[model samples]
Target chain A: MIEAIFEKFFQHYNFWAAVVIIFIGIYATIAKNNLFKKLLGLNIFQTGIFLFFISLGDIGSLETLGIGDATPPIIWKPAEERGYLYVNPLPHVLILTGIVVAAATTCVALALLIRIHKEYGTLEEDEIIELEAIRGD
Target chain B: MINTVVEQFPALIVTTGVFSAFTILILGLLSRKICYYIVLIVTAFHFILSIFTLQHVLTKGRIHYWFGGWRPPWGIEYVVDELNAYSLIVILFLGLLGIIFAKRSVEKEIEERKLPTFYTVMQLLISGCCGVVVTGDVFNLFVLAEVASLSTYALIAIAGGKALRASYNYLILGSIAICFYLLGIGFLYAVTGTLNMIDMRIILQNLYENKMVHVGFVLVLVGLGIKAAVFPLHTWQPDAYTYAPSAVTLIMSTVVAKTFVYALIRLIFSVFTVNFLELYINAWNLVPWLMGVAIIVASILAYRQNNIKRMLAYSSIVNVAYIVLGISFFNSQWSLSGALVNILNHAVAKGCAFAAVGAIVYKTGIKDVGALAGLANKMPYTSGALLISMLTLIGIPPSAGFVTKFYLAIGCLEMQNYLMLAIILLGTLLTLAYFLRVIEQLYFREGNSTQKEEVPFSMLAPTMFLAILCLAIGIFWLTGIPLEFLKKSITSMGVIFR
Candidate 1:
């Protein structure tokens, strides 16, 4: 039980870390007052997603079907004809593109935020919404 | 040497188009003014390459260009079949027309500095789209889809804050869709141990009842459905179209999004094959009946919209449902032809309509459909062209819309689908009701009493050219249609099973 607990703690560590980061991003996105902070939250949230993807793809180090055996992921023994499956390369492929997309979206969002600030003289979302209402565009 | 070149010809041509576009983009980044003309030249070269693929595909059985010469069920492949050839021609031609219109509209709407980068992004979008259609590997399809989408998000946001908001919303939803597709692809890849589409299909056919396969199919369909703007997942399209810069909106509405939908058609029909579709039908007549609902509902929704762009957006949804209906009644030659022709019919007619509306918006800054009074007097050629397109949208006689609608009705009838026929007819009337409302104001309204001013020739020329195309196509179809071979091609895709 102790080893299991220790291994669980060590294994999905990055996943949990990402989850925590995602929570912080969500909080910032919702509760923070600044527009740039909200954007920061969005960035943080996307970063968490990227981290989760990368971590998920590397979980082959701990095989679920191993059932507590200290076997490496190789067919070395005659009985061990099939070794454990390696980490999925697919998610890494997915996240690599996701990271690039996240960056592009961030650049465009920041540019729009800059334009919004220039036009309305305020960076707050509520203030901008009010300005839009007044101008009725 | 000849066999090697012949073996790799499809990939070479497809890549040539793709790389040339990328080269133009890079050059444009260094110098924007030069990029504008270069983009046109690059696209023209791509068109020539597409013609070569067309010739080869027509002569040969199918052009299968295995990636790095690695055989299928292992490495990626770029397959150019007759279906791909037809869709390639339509999509690239639309991109050509859209970019042509874009050259002038962009200069007016976008600032002086952003034009070159915008062209680069547009080229990237086309490359991504072409990659999606031609790739014989499923995983590569997803990657290409993202490449297209990433560039699209940037292109859409170039219109400024409202477009920015639209892009942000689009990014969120689009990401979810892509994630779902990747997860589905993961499932498929794990189960079959293959990424090549044809090999996977053969294997999947043997294991049709596998739970993972079912899950994968549903996920991929839903994912692609969102991209294709299927009835339920189409909320992002209108705002994205409306808030976008005129040039951006023109290309996106006319070409980019339509290419995605066409790719969805190939994935669903070609990959899944007819038996899988039959499985949906036997399981509570799912495909056909669901499509019947989509057609009726989407058309009614289109009839009710007030914003011009929103109306067109809803019309796109309604039109997409018609294509899905082809799947429901699978293997009907007429139905498939109707669905296939709708791709061109809608793109050409709507591309021109949006261009005309965009010109009107540039002149008056109006967004509401009711504001189109006496537009004929002010912008004669544009208004006249839009009027004709609206007629096409309404499926009036002697228009391309009529030709396609005729096939769809004939298709539904041949399959003994009366209820579907009734619904399509009803939708056609609803289409007429909305379009005629626009036409009535343009012609008979008293808003023309005042003096009218004309816009620049730059705006008028594109609309007039497309308007001529609309008339020429209708006349050509009347004078015995030249696309009989297209019918044979559709039949070859198991459309004649019934």
Candidate 2:
């Protein structure tokens, strides 16, 4: 049982790594008080998701099918003739879109943070709330 | 030739929005005043196109346009069935009215230089909403939802001051929500190996017992629940609604929220289907209970708010719960139709209410509910519009809200869910209590000023139009004129009307 568990863990370590990184990012986003830190945490969280998606494309070796190595998703004459296995490229394309969305979200968030800092002269969430309370908004 | 071109309307609608957004931005460099006109023209065009799309859908059946002629499951697709067509019409209709109302309000609230970009983002937001409603690809829905959300955040922040904080908080929560949705999509794709919603639905049938499918189902529900502001995940709504510009508040509270709910419905009915819920998740049994909590809690919260906008925002949550509750009783046809009709009803009622409140804020700068006393004498038309909308929201007879409640009550009877029925009744009373406060203030008490100060004709027209629509739709529903359309849309989702 122990040996079987070890083999499974080694085989799917990418998913386990993604799980750990995702939790860390969530913790930082929730636990951190600094707005900038929170944004950083959000980025980390998204990056973890991206990693999870990318790993899903990687089909490991299948000795029964005589595919020992997985190549990148490229369609060339020699690779096709040689029966080369190609990693799924759809997830990569989806993640590329996701990355652009993430960048846009970060840019908007950063702009809002700048405006918040300019308005309240602070970057801490609690301090900003306090200032808002004192001002009676 | 015309038939072929009409087939391409789905893609044209969204492309017009994205292209117009940039066009406005570039053209505004030379002439800023023209931006509003461009938005008005484009939205008008979109509204007309949506009408054509709906007419074609009703007659010709579902329209599918593959992106660049790549077939489904391999390339992105735009499918406008009865549901999408209905939602598209409602979205663009409200969007056009909101833009018409925006002319005077935007000029007043936004800085002169920001006007061009403001219109640009507004166009993007509309297009994003159109994309969300029409697209058949789940990942495409996520991307377009992000586009809409990002524009919303920018629009709210453009108001400056307290709005910045509201927008920031919304950004954090909204991004997290969309990421969860993306994760859910990833899980489904990992298992099913398909991104097209129809393909995924077929593949998900056999995989319902899989743990990953179950987790993906829950994740998607939670993610959309936040976006739709379903009771527990609604922390960001009140602030965003209260601080956003009047036009933004109107559009967000009505069109934006409704589109998300439509997406949720599409995912539940079309993508996952009823069999999945019946077999594994038993979500039909679960969602109504949560919606019951939302109805009671959100109404009470709405009652306690001092600011009128904030109160309306909470009320918006209550109405959202109503829609969810209506659909959750999946066994009852009355309930499903009630939910679909309520989407149009609530949009008209709430859009009118927010526009009136915005006009009040525009002229008098009064945010407190108590300060509304005696303004009726000065702003008669505005105050009258507010009264009608508040009445409609309280579900009085011969108004839009009444139609929804009557159908919902009949639905409850059909399902024999007495507890939900009582909750609905109690919710109505609570709604009456809060709205009566505003109505009483509008007509009963004396104001400090007596001078007539109605909003511009541009703003008043749309508010009045929506208020009239509230009564007209109620009467329309009573006459059962649109029952065929409603039944067609609901039945097209593979739901049997017993």
Candidate 3:
């Protein structure tokens, strides 16, 4: 059991890091009252997912202790030999789209924050709710 | 040559709208008058394209458009079967009507400088909905969902002041949902090594027992559930709907949520399939119970609301539950068609109701249920349309809501799920309990104003058109106009009970 735990800790450590980052991000988004911190938390959460996707493409040769065998996906030789040694390119392409999406979301989110601060002169969630309620129906 | 053009209609439908969005943006800097006209023409063309594709699908079958000339696994694809065509028709047609309604109403609510920007974002939202419905790639679907969602956050904020808070909460929640969806996609991609929907399905069939696939399924469901505003995840919806500009309210309440539900259904039926559920040890058996709770809880919440749009927002949760309930029983063809029909029925009913309420709010700035006392005397047509829509929501006969509810009841009976049937009956009662409060305020209560104030022709036209549609669909539902297409969509799912 101890050996299995050690194996999981050693082999899947990046995913464990991602899981930790995800927890922190969700906690900040849900538990934090400040709006800017929430947005930053969202970005951190997305970065965790990006890390997971990047790690999925990193299968290595048995000789290099799972770290250093796979080359960048660009082809140097023609047919059979080097093709199998290169890492998968699809996740990289998907991450490019993910980055663009994250950028767009952050821009819109910060813009809304500016507007909210302009209107209420505050950026805290509970305070905004208080203002809206005190203003009343 | 004709076959090729027909096959490419799915791609044209999305690109045209997106192309028109940029054009409107550029032309708005030069001239504002031409922008609305461009919007009308683009939506009309999109509606016509959807009709052509739906007809082509019903007769000639599904159309697949590959990006450039590349083949499936490597290239992104746009697929339009009966399911996609049906949703495309609803979205584009409503977008056309919403644009017409927005012309005058936006003039009342939005500043002149922002008009072009509003319409531009509106076009992008429509294009995003089209892209979400018709895409055959999961990652592509996520990108389009963001496009729709980001534009929506901006549109809601365009109202400014009070709307800014609503849009902020929506942004935070919506971003989290999108992240969950992306993580879900990553899990699926890691297991399957392909992003194409068909390719993923083939790969996932063998990986059904894998823990990653299970995690992927739950993540996707939770992500989309929040987007669809189902029950507990629906806290952002009421504020967003209430504070947005009326036209935004009408469109998002009907189109955006419905499109997310469509994407969820597509993921389940097309990518995951019932075989996945069987292999996953009937883990999805919880879905029906979840829908049952969403129906009961959301209806009760709708009952407690005093604000009209907020109440309607809660009711939208109930409508989403009906579709989920239908889809949960995917092994049964009857329930599946019932779910599909409910999509159209709820869209017409909810869209018309919101439009009429917008008309009333435009004429008199009242949104509370009690403040609408004697509103019927001043805005008879708008109030009447609201009455019809509310009746439809209550599932009264001769209304579109009744037809879908009838099918759902039948579906429940055929499944012999009496508890869910009881829940449905209780939900209809709850809908009646809430809507009657507004109806009484509309008709029975004394007038605050003496003079009659009719809504503008542009606004009244679309509201009445949808109200009349409520009647027509209920009367002709047995006539197989929507029934035939719904059946084709169901058969396309290839559900088998075993």
Each predicted complex: what DockQ?
0.25, 0.87, 0.87
In model 1, what lDDT does residue B367 have?
72
Q: After superposition, how far is residue A48 of candidate 3 from its true place, in Å?
A: 0.7
**What is the C-alpha lDDT profile of model 2 across A12-52, one tens digit per residue?**
78888888888888888888999989899899999999999
User: Which residue pairs collide in model 3, if any?
Assistant: none
Instruction: Give the Å error, residue B382, model 2.
Output: 0.6
Name the lDDT value of residue B246 in candidate 1: 74
The TM-score, computed over Cα atoms with residue i paired to residue i, of candidate 1 is: 0.84
Chain A: TM-score in each model: 0.71, 0.84, 0.82
Per-model RMSD to reference: 4.8, 2.0, 2.2
At residue B382, candidate 3 shows an lDDT of: 91
Candidate 1 lDDT tens digits, A19-137: 79877876776576666777787778767767765665554543553623333344354555434344556567767776776676677667767766776688776776677678754
lDDT of 2 by residue, B341-447 (tens): 99999999999999999999999999999999998999999998899999999999999999999999988889898999999989999999898888888889999
* Local lDDT at B73 for model 2: 99
* Residue ranges of candidate 1 with Cα displaced over 4 Å: A1-134, B1-26, B280-284, B448-455, B475-484, B491-498
User: Rank order by TM-score, top first?
Assistant: 2, 3, 1
Error of 2 at B199 (Å): 1.1
lDDT winner, 1 or 3 = 3
TM-score of chain B of 3: 0.98
